[model samples]
Target chain A: MPHTTPQTPGLFSLSLSKTVEFALNQALRLDEAQGAAFKDFEDKTFAVTFTDLGLTLYLFFTSYGVNVQNALQGEADARIETDLPSLLGLRETGRLSRVTLHGDVPLAEALIDALTSIEIDWEEHLSHYTGDLIAFKVGHATRSAMAATQAAKRQAGETLKEYLQFELEVLPTASQLQRFGDSVQRTQAAVDAIETRVQALLDRL
Target chain B: MNQSKKTIDFGFSEVPLEEKVKRVKGVFDSVAGKYDVMNDVMSLGIHRLWKRHTIELSGVRPGQTVLDLAGGTGDLTKAFAKRVGKSGRVVLADINESMVRVGRDRLINEGIAGNVEYTITNAEALAFPDNTFDLATIAFGLRNVTNKDKALAELYRVLKPGGQLMVLEFSKVTQPLLAKAYDFYSFNILPKMGKLIADDEASYQYLAESIRMHPDQDTLKQMMLDAGFDKADYLNMNEGIVALHRGWKY
Candidate 1:
């Protein structure tokens, strides 16, 4: 049920692939940004603190299916109250770019509040992340299955008899298996047509 | 609500604010002079094979423009110049001045005088106009970038319609035995060689760590696709020790 229609193998269909690709790119970019932050505070005690915060936020978003931008903005809003001054102090000492606080008070308190609110639901969030991974795995497996099915049909000596055997023994499903059989027949017809057209062109030349 | 509290990862290490580029530049500057030699020794000449394969896959005909990002020592640029003929132009770009200088001198010495330009440019913020290049390549480079997604987007923006982008870099070794051997070689022998040859152990250590931290072949192909590339795919070489990813703008 998680799998959608099989992706057509062509330069077209960039829409679906683009979404998956963008998410992966964002994850890697966020990781790189966190690494830079840790390196900047190498000698300071807050180095690990900042690193943990970044990693925690990353894990939290991936697991919870929360939009990262909204979650980050919410955390920033909550941290402005209690810990903003100290956070600003740390940032200054670390020589980091000045972070603009959303609220009047310090930004750290707002972040602390945001983190506290989500701590209770951490497990639930993690489960959602697992679900996303499972969905991706299913999609990958389905694609592989389709490729294998096509490859099996291409082997020589596996003609109508082999096709009959596949329908009777390999696949028991009446509806899905019939659709696949029809697809294979249609593909073969299309390939034969292309070959004939190419031969005709060659003869004319 | 500090909207600017963004974090970034540099290899396996994490850092904050805008220090990522500076650190990356430092890493490259420390090894610029010895980079080419170390590359040859590290891969035992396999790097040449990878670059040659990139050249073949590039399909850059005469009178086509090419931009080689982080084109250290101008190896790819030199090859591209010849292929593009006298009319086509090749740009050799790197963030570090030391690497840029070395590359410029190498190209000049090889008598590749005309139809080539050298610029020191950051991968994150390339200064070219939109849709400028026919082909763009980042060789042994992307892992060192501060914001790889931004760089990819920039690459996409600069490429003309139907332009191609090729990335050649280290990838996850598929075979477990080969991976273990690679790990040992990288952690043990590489730094020692760097110390002896380049007199800089830390830079080589950074190199190993960065490669380990790089996304694998499939992840990177997806990245290219995400950056608006059509028909993105990668070819694994040297038992997946390295990969060549090709994509098209169209």
Candidate 2:
């Protein structure tokens, strides 16, 4: 568990919170769904505690968007505990399992769900700064790179498995494992027969 | 010749009480457009930190009314408006019409309208009802008021029972070396920067003088207590260059 002692946030922490608030609101604004998922969460407060940073940012939902601040007056509706990396991962993957939630579990689930539901059109946003053709090219290049990386990862895994099983002979082959399983079953049956014979002799005596 | 007429400090100079109001109004009017810019440049962008600390200490909750007295450019008001949500309200009141106009326009441009109200009113005589606001704040504007005690009293009067008042202002520096350097910068560089940027040297000079004339941390805390606050305390930031005085009405 992270230490819960509240220290006064320095200017750097305040600046970080403001930056996060600005980025989150900007993303929500660019959302194709118009952030409709967050409409029901008005006036809800979610305290997100970063274990590594020892900081808690109170995310207060309003009609406009969420306000992130260091100090909160009262108990929040939901509290989430996680490290910095986990929070970043949660944002990228939109997975609630990345953090441990306390207090109103339902509210935490709904908040995360609503946050994940916002669909921002990245290409459209990029095109505002770059021309359509450049944006499309960048997007295409990014997608191709990601796909190539996945393919390479899959190929590397298959090669490693083949090398370990066939060339190195460190791991058993499929047929060898199958035969070993059969031998174990046969030995177990013989042991069962011997146990039955002993039981019969004991009973006669 | 007119000793019977009261005189007050307008910067380092003494002027009639009514003239001081006009002088303060003129200074704000001259710098209203470039107030935010000048603040950033003058403080090396540390004014934002000061204000951030003030907001952190506010501990404001949803559905609570706030009075941002002397809320020029509506920085504090904008933050409070978001925190208070749709049900609550924040009044951005200022003595200078020019300052209020600029603040109102800027806030409106930023889409901070529904929960915020703008008014041009003197701090010594607030236009709100007694025991009305959950929180009241006067930031960087206390020294410009003709009567500091009267303004503090008004802030205390407008706050509801259990509500708090936060005063964020420039104060006397505690360290001698830093104080000497700060004084040199204020008296020498600040006005020139104002002239270079805002085209107003005199107003910036007045700013430095007014800050010097403002009460120190302890004095301001005592003033809040004298104004009927049950408990009063202060937190100095940047080694006493700026202080945040908080008083709770019980």
- State the displacement of the C-alpha of residue B109, model 2, in Å, after optimal TM-score superposition: 1.9
- Per-residue CA lDDT of model 2 for A1-205, tens digit only, reads 0113235676656766776677678878888877788888788888888765556888877876878888776678899887655544554676644588899989988887876676533334333434533444566578878999999999999898889999998988889999999999999999999999999999999
Candidate 2: where are CA atoms >4 Å away? A1-7, A91-98, A118-205, B1-4
Model 1 chain A is weakest, by summed lDDT over 10 consecutive residues, at A40-49
Native contact fraction per model: 0.00, 0.44
Error of 1 at B103 (Å): 0.4
- Candidate with maximal lDDT: 2
DockQ for the candidates, in order? 0.01, 0.18
Considering every candidate listed, which one attains the maximal TM-score? 2
**TM per candidate, chain B:** 0.96, 0.98
Q: Model 1 misses residue B166 by how many Å?
A: 0.1
